[model samples]
Target: MARQPLAPVRPPCRLYLITPPHIAHLDAFAAQLEQALDAGDVAALQIRLKPAEEGDIRNAVQRLLPIARAMGVAVLLNDRPDLARTLGCDGVHIGQEDAPLAEARRILGPDAMIGVTCHADRDLAWDAAEGGADYVAFGAFYPTATKETAHRPELELLSTWQETVEVPCVAIGGITVDNAAALARAGADFIAVSGGVWAHPDGPAVAVSRFAAVLAAVAEEI
Candidate 1:
């Protein structure tokens, strides 16, 4: 058979920053977040505080939302569409266990961005896309300490989705400067990183800048 031409490259992949499961010092973390966002092309920030009181969640949002908005970065609350709505967040990210896509859509309204965690499930991705999700996420392409990940999606999943789906796909889990370029080339529209940025040895700002550099290189190659 003759060689086949590749599909047209999708738009460059951008960084999606997810907050740590816990933010011990709100002021310190907020300042770090501001620096990180200022350092690169972050598409959005997900305020994902686990086992936190509703009050803490609200406080974090109150403190961090303005910083993100000031940099033109969207703010998303993980697994809390109601809070997202009441707090005036730009969107919400829901896991398969968190809420049904339909209910989330109804709650957030048509304008809000809602992303579904499809993990490595093709059916889940398709269902979310057909159900009007702004985006579908797949991961953990690499092992992540941020959370336990049972599903490890293959790079081919991203490649195939790029060739077919109009809804953007976010490649999440353990993504860092070292591994991000491959994900970008594999067709991830956004690469979600939590520990990769926050836990970096140099600092969050440097980590963000490095990821930006990696994505830039991938964009030029494609």
Candidate 2:
């Protein structure tokens, strides 16, 4: 089947934030999220609450989505298209094991931004893009404890994808400020970060500021 070309991403590259695998306090995290968004430009936020009950996920999304949306950040829910649509999130990010892309699109409609995890396989990424994914995520470009994945895509993958694909590509997994510039230069449309920001010694705001600085510097050089 012929694939529909993805809409081009503006500004070329940006930060994509993911929540900690677990959030014990929604209010505290909401404050931190606001600070991070305030400190720099973030394109989107993924409410990734693994192992949490549906009610807990709903609560977190209700509290955090408004903060992100108010700052013009898109909110994405991980692994649950049904809840994402039901709870009014901007989109859902589906893993290889999650709902099929067609199903997710059916549930959320064409307007919803649906992203698919392609791991290290260009073939997988092509499949997702051809299947109508809004963006295709490739990772772990660096080692990560955020989630366990066997595939480790190299920096060159982003470069290659950028050269060939119209769909935006996201570089994820253990991406930190010190190393993010390389990905930005390599042509990642978005850098998906979680522990790298939340676990930074200086704090999320400082981490976001540093990442923004790196990306801005890279943008100038490009």
**Top candidate by lDDT:** 1
Q: How many backbone clashes does candidate 2 have?
A: 0
* Model 1 residue 123 lDDT score: 95
Candidate 1's TM-score reads: 0.96
TM-score of every model versus the real structure: 0.96, 0.95
> Model 2, 59-144: lDDT tens per residue?
99999999998999999999999999999999999999999999999999989999999999999999999999999999999889
CA lDDT scores, all candidates in order: 0.95, 0.94
Q: What would the per-residue lDDT of candidate 1 be over residues 77-193, giving only the tens digit for each residue?
A: 999999999999999999999989899999999999999999999999999999999999999999999998999999999999999999999999988889999999999999999
List CA RMSD, all candidates.
Answer: 2.7, 5.1
Per-candidate clash tally: 0, 0
Model 2 ranges off by over 4 Å: 1-10
- Give the least accurate 10-residue stretch of model 2, judged by summed lDDT: 6-15
Off by over 4 Å in 1: 1-9
